[model samples]
Target chain A: MPGKTFEEQVRQELIGLRLEPSQQVWETLAVQLQQKHKRRRIFWLLMLMLCLLGASGWWWIQHNTDLAPGHAWTTHADNSTATKTTTTTTTPILPERIQPDTTPSTVISQTTTIPAHQNRDKNDYAGTADQLPVKLLNRQAPRTNASVNQSGRYTLPVGNHQKSALSKDLQREAVPENGVIKDQKSQPIPAQDNRIKQSVTAAPAFRDTVVISEDSKKSVVSAVLRLPPSDTTATEKNTRSADTAALPVPTHQPVDSTKASVTPATQSAGKSGWSWAVQVLGGLGGTRKSIGSLFAAPDPLRAYNPIGSGSPGSGAGSGGTATGAIPVVRDGASLGFEVAMEKKIGPKQRHLLGLSAGYHFYTTQLKVGARTAGTLLFNNFNVSNQTGYYFASRDSLNYTNYYHFLEAAVQYYIPFSFLKANMRWHTSLGINYLLTSNGLHYDYSGNAAYLFQNNSLFNRLQLNTGSGLDMQLGRKKPVWAGLQVDYMLGNLSKQALSDQHLFRISAILRIPLQKPARK
Target chain B: MQDEKKLVKDCLKQHPAAQKQLYELFAREMLGICYRYTKSMHDAEEVLQQGFIKVFQYLHQYRSDGELGAWIRRIMVNTAINYLKRRPQYQLDLSFEDAHLHPVDNHQPDLRVQMKDLLNLVRQLPAGYQTIFNLHAVEGYSHVEIAKMMGISEGTSRSQYARARGLLISWLENHGINDKKDYYAR
Candidate 1:
């Protein structure tokens, strides 16, 4: 309705005016909306991936803990039992796998020269023999008093009592040359060895005793001796003599030597052998909290219409122009650092599992208020009475939460040729246990402190999944440099202001504790 | 009324045909509102596209308490204000001497001139005057509300609106539009 006056008519005309927009505007809006939809889809897809990774990681840890190491040890124990029953004399010869540089004379002098009848069926002796570096079925040794079996195979003779005496004398002479046996009196005789010698008389060796000597006096004498199962008296006498002569060498030295010799053999088995790595990672992180009804839109005006309302001069009051609340989040940049140890799994070293502890610090500022209606607007808290409030302040509450977590991760590597360098793509899944949390420190402005004082909200744990490109730093070094993008699953808060996620991009350096020797 | 509600529901579900329909229904009036705040037709079109995008984005926030057109109008006005604040040239200030300058009125109103002519005259005014006039006169926002929206004092808003009105009246009268014509006849 146009008024009589020119001004009123002008106002009426302008209020009702509608100018057509260009056709291209709709197409542009459509394309823009499509892109937004695509972005939202990508975000959800990433979230799904993180969830799957976490679930799979939890399953993997549960499945492998009891199976891998237990199976390997069982098989090794069975093999040791078979080897003990087939051989009569416990000659501690170094295994062929061990390096030749390790002195066999030291091992022989350390071994108890007890005859088989007194020390036979002793589990500790069998275990010690099993651990010895002695080579089984060595074809290189000289044959003396060889026995021909029905299968046409020549068996090495079990040395008689006289050979056993000669072997014992050689061992007694060689014991003085082993300077590594520094503490003779401190070495305690194994209880099993003492029990057998007390029950049975010494039996002179009914088995074979072969003595091999080097030209130099300093050179080690390797003696391969076996005791007969039949002569209990001779075995007891031999056990007593062997125990007296070998009592000077500490039992632990042999074990240490065995481990030192076994290390290279285990290393060559595969990359799957346990090699520890320490990683130092630093990254930037961002956090967001969705505080549901804590920030809601202001109530709309009742029974007010802009089109039906009178002219601008009529002073239609503040009826239809209600101020709405806008949620404003100021996410501060975060700094995070972690130290972790990783172990390779499987024969090909395709998977690396790690346990890491890290500290992450984040600060965020949150504010909810109206833009227009200054301070005179009613406080939404007192909805019943509609208490009038003023000064809609821009002040915000700052929350800083620092947390430390221990995380277990499993990663798979896909190696590819990149720029003539060995580069690998690593995908990992991890679960974090929040060890401790420095509770939310609320720094509120004015009235907000009183409003949010009792809010108890924090995250106890989270799941993380990441992928990165790792490049070997050098051929000689077991160090790797990588660029990683890690996505954490779960809310930062358990109750109020939940639904927060953390994403971190970091450059990582991994250094192996024992560097693999270069080929 | 039922058709409008159903169209909104379908648009919320991202039905393409419904989105096009809603756009066609509101694009014209929203464009007019944007045109009043921007400098050129091109700028107005840009603002209109962005404003419509926001409408669809926050459509779920719209309660059935008010008219859908009014809700969309509020969003478009806010979008225009945001667009002006982002551009350095369109920042509102009262210290400029031209804001204090009064255009001389020599002739009576030209009623024969169409609404487009009046919009052209409004666009010719300075950015500050144009925004305050649109918010106060056409959009029916009070001086207090306009002051808060533009981050200026209520006094500044009243003065700016007054200057804008004077300039528009002068421009219309100069074009020889007679006030004696039947105002209701288009």
Candidate 2:
């Protein structure tokens, strides 16, 4: 009978060999694994924080909208309208959080008092004593009947039946350059005493009368109109009178010569809260060597057997011929795309804070010499192809390394005018967290060249800074298109062998999700 | 196969139980591989510990299309090679007489060589011969691959392997192991 060859016999015998290792090995491995998992937990925690920050920002926008003065009035009035009576009044005081710091100290006395019973009998008169307007009074006056309390807050007695007190602060805001009110067409209005009386009588939709006066004798009230929630298209006659009751006068600033400045400030306050914009960005990037080259081997290879040798060590022992110096190569290009939501942060709408989720693809190309015949090389596991093994037969082989990451980043943009008013320059800073990615590193150390997957090999988080120039496109609701350049500040990989950072140049387009904030 | 897939998935999630189970599944065979490369069981266990760490660290890279045990075995071989290369004591020097040898032609009627004894005999060879023989004859690597891994010419790898094989056969015959029963038998 024919027998197996010696090599085959040895392979067969050793293939089934098993020798159990000591228990200490597993214990050490477990400890190492625990430490690695701890780091992973921290990464996940950062991702969670980014999501929670975006969620909370969204919630704040909704909360502010619900509490707008107009919306709040519509809701509170609808609720309290049922308990309405002629004898009792309820004043809608602005929440302390929203109160302006420069509230005035003077109270306006009612100069033109109307017959309460006469208006009460009218069907159009929704005015109730329980729904009187907020009052401003002198801080120095006696606290007996109408003085502001010690903390400068005075709550009106709801059922007192006395007319609502007018704040001197409100009267000051109502008084402009000439101390008189005017219509939208720049036409001068009627005398102060009669206008206040006529405004109270003409505004039948008001459940409470709006009284604006500096004193009983000199009643100087200006007409600053805010359209009511109901009948937004009504004539200036009714809107100017009715909306005054809902306005919370800002405390500071000298009297403006023109009403244009005050009207827009009031309108924007009621209409705009947080303005969101959608940004679409795409860019090409490349990496620079940061710390060291990962491809350079730690030690030079020494050959056991020399070429044209009599014996293995005849001439190959100490003076072994060295392979040529390993060439230092730079990694290849990277491409990225992101869709983000930007929220205008300040009242002037000059600064924007944004949250983005994006895809970042990085590639590393190297010249791995020709693949030997009948040799197997490992590739990153591609979902499309079940097998990760491939043969490289060409003289020059490029390893198109891929890193697919789901990146979450927080970015802040500071906007300033550049060459013209229409062109804006925005400098931005961003903190990015690469939540998850495939870790594929090409290692040529083993018997065959294979792509090794190790998550700890790459840096997953980094800071980036950039600047962009945006040109306003449209006249009405402007669209902004810009060119942006971003530089990532650190190494791409955690390994000391690589010190490469990513830099990108991109085109960005921004469109407002809501109407642009009032200029 | 389904259980193995689940075990790999769980281990990727860093589940301690699944990790321990995966470790237990391959530890013995891997230690045996490590033992063949090192001088002592202690050194073998050290290589085993380091190799298993790499296995778990890179488990996610292991494509399920291939056998998991085979993937781990490759990593163990790499770790063992690195361990030997790093230490001064285990540094390989394969220089020896490149001479003609008589091929083993005698067929043993009855063979009774204990597996451990055979392993000892193989270990008794020089480190360079032992490594070249294991890489070529046991691991199924070609002379070209061994040459690339050890930075030697393909001709030298083939000659070294031939010398190792001849030495091992002579040692086997001289020990009265051929056609002998119950002599250090398993």
Candidate 3:
């Protein structure tokens, strides 16, 4: 009734305002947010990767203590179980896949004129009487035999006994028959492969015997042998070259000869057959717990608006305006590094699933509202009670104030990937459970310490270091041999500050490691 | 097709397109409130921009409560008031002269014409009378509320509204648009 006429008139005027609607200002805001996320992504990712790497290394080096080699002895010495023996032997050999030995060949002759017990052995295969120089190539057991004691750091004597008729001479300085052995007798007669295979009948024929000298304890095997390419491996090599191809069938092969061979690995593996690689990641980024940053908003004016209150747990004040930039913790730039190992299981599909373990050292920090070394703001931590948000407490970490956090987490990993020439588009997702924490730390009146002495908060917070969507993935065609890129996501909670969530982008290089070959 | 002006831009650039989005989101509500506080559309639009720029500049300050549009409208109203104080407008004279006659009845005037047309009639009043009319009739502000807002006396606000309403009624009559109920009776 009062301003009805005024209101009507105003409506017509309202429609007459600027016809060209604009929102340039908000566009800028969106752009700023995107850029911020991208940059922060690089640093936090580094920290997370480092954390993983460090954790894995620590766990591995600690539990993998049995890597040191042990003694070896004859596992196959049963002269009592003699049965009808044959004089002929046949081998199903794929010659097309066999490459010739390029290493210097030694010609040692072994003439064992033992009392030929008239072919008296049941396990013996029927063989032709072509009395050529019979030389037993090494016979290895399958990986299962030494799985219980397979030292990730040391090679052991599992099985290696394969006899073959050859034109070359047989020389046996000393054959280690059992585990790791330093003292043993030397029997220089060409032995049969069946003897070694039978000794470790329970395992796949790839676990080679770690032969030790009868006098010297040094192992004669210098490196892990490379086996002839398997059908699966051959296809995988091709697919790996195709830039965009399918999973490589498992190509692991058993060595055919001791001189030039690829030793088959004897460790129990996850779905992805390859043993987990320990990767150490290190970098520098923003620290979410800058003292100046924690106190940036200065919760002033506790006026009652009936909306809500900003106390400890009842409600969290929007700590401070996000627009305000935080200062640096150190001058040059904060550096953080972590070590983690990932053991891929499951065949090489577009995505690989596995259980990996690692250690991490991630120290990220950003100056909270820049103050010089000798300045009053940096020198003093006397937080004036601008807002009565805290109960009687002297420490700032107890309340949500100036602080820093150091935490470690164990995670399970899943990786998806695509390859471009020389680059790999990789996406890794993982869930990390915090195992230990050096709670929020800060320079409180120059007394830097952890925020909490114990964990009372009941919430599950995952810190995803640098796992995310990768834009540039593969390097070689389908995939070159060794280059990779990994991204990580790091965060503690939903209401976490931007810096609290770590996102990192990294270039990875993996070297195909070789095991000590059989002599 | 979407307006070329409303194209999305890099938010960091503070591009025109971003501003256009902000404007599109709050324009209607902001205008409705702005018009109630200002004397004219020109004043209202200026106040709208002034308010929008502040909202955008401090956009990052907005946290979880999602309804940013509503929050911005309140700012538009305040901006309109601040604008008037910064650049005051001259008030229209309320001295009633020749046709000042006694009221015939206590009943209110009736109208059957379009709301837009009736509003146009009220717009014909000077700036001072327009503001008081809008504050009382549309915003439901008391004379005291209007006075406090414009830095004027309650008496002045009441007088301005009375004058503005009289002129609107006369304007409607001159248009040969007599009160519908009364004309039906005749």
Candidate 4:
């Protein structure tokens, strides 16, 4: 047989070669694989949590946006009417009232009885007439007359525009009209027309009585008004009219009514008012290497040194001494409490400017050490003239720092709808002024005692930026809960003992003291 | 074969016992493969561990059509190449001097030189030469495949394999070992 080639022989010899690995390799591999699996599991769990939070936030936002537009419309209309009524009453003889009625003859005849009541309360009549144009009022007048004729039970016109304003007045008279008009229907058509005219003229007096009722009842009226116009029933109208008549009418009410003027401002404030919130935050903070420490001399005491010169307790030292001390700082926990107020800006009330004052406490432990060596010559000349010694000392210093911070920030809220709740992404940038710091404890051992001072050791200013999700809570949802993380820029340490980059996470509850009324 | 497919599926699910069984079945041969590309047994074992981890991590991507052993071997080879690339000392240069040629005598060969001895001889070659020789000769990768794997030209891979073979043959001959295996036995 021919001899195998070099390559062929080598391939043949090594092709099936196998070498066993030691048992330790398998153990290490198993541990690594288990750790990888654990890490993967943890990553997925966090992803799931994040997805849930996002989904809840989305749901909250959707609920709020869906109701906002309707609520805003009612509040604006009520506020504008209230203001218009007050202005019209104060200036009863305005030139606008003198302008010849340019309306059509049909509208003039329908509204001829309004001028007689207008002389009694100019503001109320003008407000009602101005809001209800001739076209709209005429359409509802025919309906009211037709409903009364058909039902003989004295059904009232449930016009959409007048429903909110007159529902309370009409509700008191509805029950009486139902009983009285049924009996009178057999008497005379002329008598029924006279009664209708009399009831229409008495509306202003009933409105005065409704105004004197509890302010809380006005919200009920506004809510009822929000219902679909077709759903208003004769019984509902009678209940409202009964409620109105039960109250005593005011003889001469003030032109600027408290409920009308105050309610609108309160409602508007609900939408764009100044709001305050208090937050308590706690987190762990780490100190980076200080710039001063980087440039400072290396600690000489780090290495072992033989005793050379002076006795440690001796009062006097003669020879040149070499000492090195380094200050080492460790990470610690931080606690903070803040009270902040925010005001809505812009037409959409999506921008907020806020100012906050807070107090923060940080506790840190520092280790300071020094190694020193020197030769001491004693004046007493008793034994040896030169005493050589080396001594090293380490001391732990605990510091609790209290800082007062004043911060101002501008926030933008991005509103999005998810399911039911109102949610907004609130992002902000702010500057923090360290108003004061206290409880800086300085303690050291041996030659390192001079490094720290109780005062002038920390920078008093920093800038921070953060973002979080704000979710509306409760039925009215006047309260909001926010989760935020703030990163403070710049160093905290003045002398480079530690760098002052701070990270803080906080859960915040915002209560609206006042909000701009949605219009 | 069905058992192997099930074992592979279990390993993909990260079943520890199945992973260990898979490791036990192939680790020894894979270690030998790693040893040829690396300079030391420790490095070979490290490569073997890392390659097995990667195999478990990416096992789901493995198709059922091919043999599991071949797939694992491919991963080990790629891992060894990567390990060489990561080392600061492993430079890809073809400036090595040609091995001195010695005349071969026709004689009865000694079969006593174990496979471990041949492995040791291969391990003694330069990192670049050892990698190319292992890929082409033992792993049966063509020069073109070796070049792509090592990020080098095909001509460079061929020349380095030749140098590596010449050097290994010279060492065996110097040690008085004969190549008596039949060339056409397969």
TM for every model, in the order presented, reads 0.40, 0.35, 0.27, 0.44
Order of quality (TM-score) = 4, 1, 2, 3
**Model 2 C-alpha lDDT versus the unseen true structure:** 0.49
Query: Over the stretch A140-197, how does candidate 4's per-residue lDDT look in tens digits?
Result: 1221221112212222333354445456554643323331221111221121221121
RMSD in angstroms between candidate 2 and the native structure over all alpha carbons: 18.1
Model 2 regions lying over 4 Å from their true place: A1-11, A19-28, A65-183, A186-425, A428-465, A468-519, B1-25, B31-186
Please tell me which model should have the higher lDDT, number 3 or number 4.
4
**DockQ for each numbered candidate:** 0.26, 0.28, 0.05, 0.26
How well is each residue in A220-276 modelled by candidate 3, as lDDT tens digits? 221112122222343333323321121112222321232111111112222334433
Best by TM-score: 4
The recovered share of true contacts, given per candidate in order, is 0.63, 0.69, 0.03, 0.60
* Top model number, lDDT: 2
Worst 10 residues of 2 chain B by lDDT: B177-186
What candidate 3 gets wrong by more than 4 Å, as runs, is: A1-10, A13-338, A341-381, A384-519, B1-186
TM-score of 2: 0.35
Per-residue alpha-carbon lDDT of candidate 1 for residues B1-186, written as tens digits (9 for 90 to 100): 788889889989988789999999999999878888888776787778778889989989888667999999999999898878866667635554333434333334545557766666777778888888888878889988997887877777777877777777766666444433332211
Candidate 2's DockQ is 0.28
In angstroms, give how far residue A78 of model 4 lies from its true place.
20
Predicted candidate 2 versus true structure: per-residue lDDT over A1-519, tens digit per residue: 126667777887777789877676687567657756775785588468545744653444332211112221211111222122112222122111112113332232322112222222232223433212222211101111222333433222211222122233233234344533332222344333322322221121222322343322233232222222232222222223333222222121222212211111122222233334555555554454432322232211111111223232223223443221122233444555565655556786456666666766555443323222233322222222113433221112233345555556666655544443345566666666665454344333222333334556567787777778876553223446788776667656653344456556677766444322111
Q: How many angstroms is residue A317 displaced in model 1 relative to the true structure, after the best TM-score fit?
A: 58
